[model samples]
Target: MLVRQCKSNFLGWIVPLLLLSITVHTAALAQCSPGAIICETFGTGTRGQLPQGQTNFSYRAIPCPNDGEYNVMDTVASSCHGDAWHRVTEDHTAGDVRGNMFVVNASYQPSEFFSQKAEGLCPGVTYEFSMWVMNINKVLQPGPCDEFSLRNPIIAMRIEQTDGTLIREVVQPAVPRTTTPVWVQLTMQFAIQTNVNDVVVKLINKGLGGCGNDLAIDDIGFRPVHPTLTIQFPNSTATETTVCADTRLTLSVGAATGYPNPVYSWQQSQDNVNWTAVPGSGQATYTINPVRAGRTYYRLRNAQPINANAVGRSQCSAESNVLIVNGRPDAPFSIGDDLALCEGTSQVLRAPEPLPAGTTIQWSDQSTNRQLTVDAPGNYWLETNLNGCTYRDTINVAIQNCHLEDIYVPDAFSPNSDTVNDKLVVMHPGTFTAYSFRVYDRWGSVLFVSKQADTHWDGTFQGQPCLQGVYAWTVDYSVLNGQNQERHFARSGRVLLVR
Candidate 1:
């Protein structure tokens, strides 16, 4: 294999440099990777309102908050010693006033300071949850709260459902006490394994307060992180090459680690726009047979399943760069090319219409005909005997599945959290080559978007519960046609979001 496997090093800064928007620290979230969307920026200002419905603590308009209370603030206040403590002057967002950040004093017991629910999210995708936080407590020499006695800031972040079904969790254990404020980012990436479209996030403070358990946070975001894939040739980094006909070549694929389990499929194409999968070519390495005299393209496709036990889909899949192989034949003769066909479909291969007298033709199948209809994929040769001379030509007929399929959707669903039709699921046979689903409000606001055929809607938008009414849904998908071709389809309908 020419390509080396990409690995994730959570302990190093390189991973963040590759996957996160912030490269200043060991941030793990897919911060600014492609398709990343910020769920919350808090707000912008020297001091902004404490985010409503996002945190459980009481909002106090003070630079320093009391136990079970928090406020978004800028600037600072004197410490217990009446002296200015190690305080942050601004927020975490760059180029802006560092503006304001979440300032909190640890509660007596564990409590969630931030809670949010996101719905209509796509399925089978690896999403990264991240936030910038800092331990704002300062240790003054000859002070009451010594390093040994002061408790460090600690917190737990998790994703769950309304029914309290735990999906995943990441614990900071403890944010080390610092003399000066240092903003660091913490991130966690995981896959959505089920059809449930509602994902709830909670950040709980577990530190005990009295002296030195204080923290500030900013730039909380959630986004998708897909593996980077590449194809390589042995002893070469070139993506395109010219070789003689009948030349054998070996290619390998490599991808970054993070996704649960990813499926690999090798594809071939004459024009880069249209691709056809090579039958049984689902491995890290693929061997190309003797090249035919023509220009051909090859690439790798990667699809990660929702979890280890699930099948992968193309909606959130990754495609590799194309590798062009131009074949130069020692003996050049043009037999032309056969147009691709759908599986179980037919194509007629006709010989020259104005044939010379005394001309006879025999196909590879031993059938004598001027034209033959092929329904399957393989090589077909035609031998023409005319003027006491014979000529032979071959054609490789491509056949694949390109059938358009539909998804089953209900006219309405109840999201009362009663677990009975609580979501509107876009049901399909799970065989689509590509798929996308979306739900929209009457005013043209998008409520949900799904990448998998089995995704659903939880009747919520932006952490706010939606009212009972009719909502529109649209679906676009592609299925296998003959010759591994993709047959595209689209559908739309209205459904009631009953409370």
Candidate 2:
């Protein structure tokens, strides 16, 4: 009874055949961007012939190509795009458009393969491959024994040289038997090694078959990959071209995609004609230590070429705009040696002449002017910076007190208003803080008094010309000493007033 039931179940369909007529709504085709070297949709050309640039096995039965026997399918149930798809088959769909499926019967053959040759490929160029595949196993009734069960086929996409040597392989798990056909997408990316010009893309079916080994492929693509490299800092396009001298500058390189270990070499030039490589400056980032002064130029070169293709040659090198490093102005500015000033006196400190354009001068007191008026005695300094270097100069200033010995007082004068020797006056070389002059008569009575050191006695008593005789006059004054200390002084003398 068990044997009878198994046999009956094996002959009956698992799913109704009516559903096979239902069409599946697949997503839109994914195509490579512009500039692709090769993009094959298999949508053009006659149904029975291979794609425009593709070929099939030229040999006979048994031990056929590993790509297996293939054809174009237009059937709604198997096609991936608008009415067409590339199908691999074992027998039923041979030389006909009715067969829109790829089948591998490993029970009769061990290896079956399909291949397409892509030409004009660049040497040492990166490319991407994309395609869609679907497993087309029909649901069958239960079998009496598991010996006739459907076997999933292992599918692999390979990139090969002209001699059939493998360059890269992308393998997919065996397609499981499904009630409804389902499309699977696969993508592979690789870089062609140096000296390689052309490559063949092969799809191989490696599976033992007694059951389902059907597959459908569509929308294949091949295109060159473009990687971007941009200079980030010390932007060459900026308006300002000057940088500080003696400063450490950083050059940065940025990438959008591509090389995993990109190599960089930085070079500098004075005249923009002859460039020299900077030692130890090979990386994504390079720092210039103590940058030189004057106008200079910089450029970056990719030591490790990302792609050998001529298409990317321009991106491999970048030239920066002119860089002008402003150096510090000359040092040792002459503001004179140590200087001395009397109390209440000021001296002007002037910066050296012939200042460079864009040079800035700053005094120790934070004054940016070219000259500073300093009254207090102390150490005064000036700093000048140009292009990024700083130069400094300093001078010591001494404040001293006034000395009484430097003062002269005349004791005799004629009040005849002759303009000369008309009055008794006190004169001093330095500034005076306080002064007083007084005259006394022979009777010891005060006759004239004055408080200003510059004021003079007219040899008068109460606005009246005094008689020409011996008169006693006294003067008092105070002055700052060498230590800025105030000292008082007094002098009394007898003067003869003449009319």
Candidate 3:
């Protein structure tokens, strides 16, 4: 979308997009800004005819032609010139399907092929003129002539005043042939001197007529490329561009811009791909509605008001980098997870509070209460809103059973087939760090031993059942304390094992 102005509030700060009409500096040729003030994409589709030109060459309606002739076609078969020319499968412009390129077969003598008068340029503005060119001659030939001995295409582009006074001329070197179509873009910059609002662009052939000097050209573009504009927040050295929500702040280029009188366009987007212009006149300042609470992308475009082709049909504009704004409330809080509760006990869960006035809260259980009664272990969440910012937070809860005693060992057990107390096992409610349970005989011989909490003895020695009498048992273990440090403990007792 296109607009001349836009405004957004950054945490109480209002950011306004402004269109500045600055003074023009000396028209010295220099650096480039990526905006299209004049672009001839050659447009879509195959013309299947010759483009209007100022050349002495013939206009061929066919895709392939002899010397001193040219054609505008999307594709030229490699077999068109008896398999001598490289196959042109696509246009020089990316994503331009079935787009035509200007194909030329060199004349016997050098001559001018293109000449046009460009007007509406802002005085003192420097512009970059560029076009994509490709050599259509195959590197390897089917003829007796080889690449080293064959001629190449050399095109020259010149810029001059309307009366034909020379400004600058760039003559391209002979473009070399390739196995496949290889497009190269030629670029040159020229400045519009004071009071100069028009200029003439011309293209001339400088190569000798030969079997290998065939070429194609497309996507010509020209635009103001000097005194680049950079938009940044105050404290330009700091990378922080964020402003507080709901604030009004004016953004400006600050320094004097050297481009005559340029028009500005402001635009905003949810996603950077699609843009909507900010609405306003071509003035220095305009207002945009208060920014909504989310991330909003913005940009400022600079262009000349005078009518160039791109400006008359679409406006010659250069857009700025995207500016992102976010609105947020600094209220942050948290709840505990993996909580421990004693047997037959319950705990209260509180929504993050000590909240500001006019704040609202809702628990996951649909409870509006500030504190919730939780009896079982599970998950809980809270949705909160204060001022104009909203937030949702969640926490998980798992039951951790704890007892006054750390470990519990069975006193006695029988190895009978019946599912009675047939195994001696250790039981504990607290988490274990290390443990060893063992049973010893009267002679101090190790009779049974285990390391795992779930492992047990079957009142037997190897494969034989133990004698029906009392057996000495001992347990050495360690369990984690409140501070998560291990506490060592030992216990020894005599248990009667009935086998």
Candidate 4:
């Protein structure tokens, strides 16, 4: 192995020095690594498995690199507090190291990458492992894990045989060994395996002296894992699983491993133990038409195994969460329409038959997170989105509640069309929706009826201006509390017609 040191001009400056650090931290929720392998690779900011409120280095790989790949890990120290350390003290930094090969420290665990299989070496073909090493913080130990008893960074690189056994371990000098932050590189030469059906080299984090130390890794890779196969399939999942027998199943691919343009096949089974390919389509879905009366199983089958030569291969299949196939409930027990309420009223979209206490009612809203509350009027749907035959349903929302705020009308009104309260508008103290208002003379002749109070009366009826007098009006409206039922209220009031 050869040693290469890459340094910045601002060595002792904590703030500017820390700016050169490179990190790779990922989790199942983070960016998908090459070959669709999941890893906890976090970046300078808090993301995925990376710690919060702190910066750490991290990265991932689809498979272990035959030569070597980068490693992501974290470490902490208290004494020297800065981005880069000029003198050994205390402070934590996350980064990676490179050389002929590297190994993880005994204290911090780093992510690893391996090759699908080792290949025979050609003439003049020597395996080379190098990492763009960045020691975020170089500090001497103050306490427990921070104490660097064993001069080693939290990284280790090793090559494995086709059968997944270690053949050789690549060694590198302790990263951050110097008080000053620098990229002290190491390199080694290895003969490619001849009988090597496959090779898997990995970079990992070992507990460095059983104390807290951190580092970040990026661009961990093997340039020639596969000459022909350049892409892989990403992990796939279903937007929703358990559904009615006739319901359509939607599957989604999260991350793919090894090469793009890979093929996909969907399989179905009456019992999860047995599976049959869904005909006519290789998409991520399998709609079980003429569904049976019980639960069904579905899985994603790849055209080729992720590790073509690995033991048990990558058999990707997850059982359906579960769905019920009970026919629609008897009569009105399931069929019905609903009314809408104020934007803040609860509406019962579905009313299932009485069940034992604690019988969980599942809905499409996955609303299990909180109690179902209908605070407005709109189209709403709910279903058990499970794998049971009888666990699904949809519903509509319509509210018919009108409320009045109970307003006072002055005895005198200036039939003036001023923008501010120019007309005799209806007022109420409370709120309501879908309301109706009507006014009548002493003779009971309906003079005006309005659905909304955009503009009140102009002291005229049927274009024949009426003299100033007292008019009676009635308001009818409904209120939707948090229940399916609506409350109706009726009130009469007097308003004086003014000139």
Candidate whose lDDT is highest: 1
Candidate 4 lDDT tens digits, 1-499: 1111122110110000001122322211112223321211223322222222121222233111111222322332223234322331211223322111111223334434222333432211223333334343455565443553633454555667656677766445445544544443333334444344345555444434333243333322221122121111223232323334443434434344322444555555676666666676454444445444455555554433332222112212221232222322211124245554664557554445553333345555566432355666565554433323344445566655343334445545656556654567766555566577887898999988888745467767898777777888887776555554667877778877666
Query: Would you list the C-alpha lDDT of every candidate in the order shown?
Result: 0.66, 0.56, 0.63, 0.41
Q: For residue 78, what is the lDDT in candidate 1?
A: 52
Return the lDDT, model 1, position 465. 89
Q: Find the number of clashing residue pairs for candidate 1.
A: 16
Greater-TM-score candidate between 2 and 3 = 3
Encode model 3's per-residue lDDT on 173-206: one tens digit a residue. Answer: 7777766678766666555665666667677888
lDDT of each residue in 1-499, candidate 2, tens digit only: 0011210111110100011111232443434335434444444223344433343333222222223344453443333222122333321222433323222333334353566655544444455555456655555553533256555667666667779887776556666555555555555556656666566666666665444454555544444444544544565544234555656777666443234464566677887778787888767677777666677666665523543223223222333333334433233356788888877899999998887777788999998987999899899998887755676778899887545446666657787877989988777878778878788989989998899776778887777788889888787888887677888988888887877
The CA lDDT at 287 in model 4 is 46
Listed in order, each prediction's TM-score against the native is: 0.45, 0.36, 0.48, 0.25
Candidate 1 regions exceeding 4 Å error are 1-43, 74-81, 120-127, 141-148, 166-170, 189-191, 194-197, 221-228, 233-236, 239-301, 305-315, 318-499
- Rank order by lDDT, top first? 1, 3, 2, 4
- Looking at candidate 2, the ten consecutive residues that score lowest on lDDT are 10-19
Candidate 2 regions off by >4 Å? 1-29, 32-36, 44-46, 51-69, 76-107, 139-146, 164-170, 225-309, 313-499
Name the candidate that leads on TM-score: 3
Q: Model 3's lDDT to the true fold?
A: 0.63
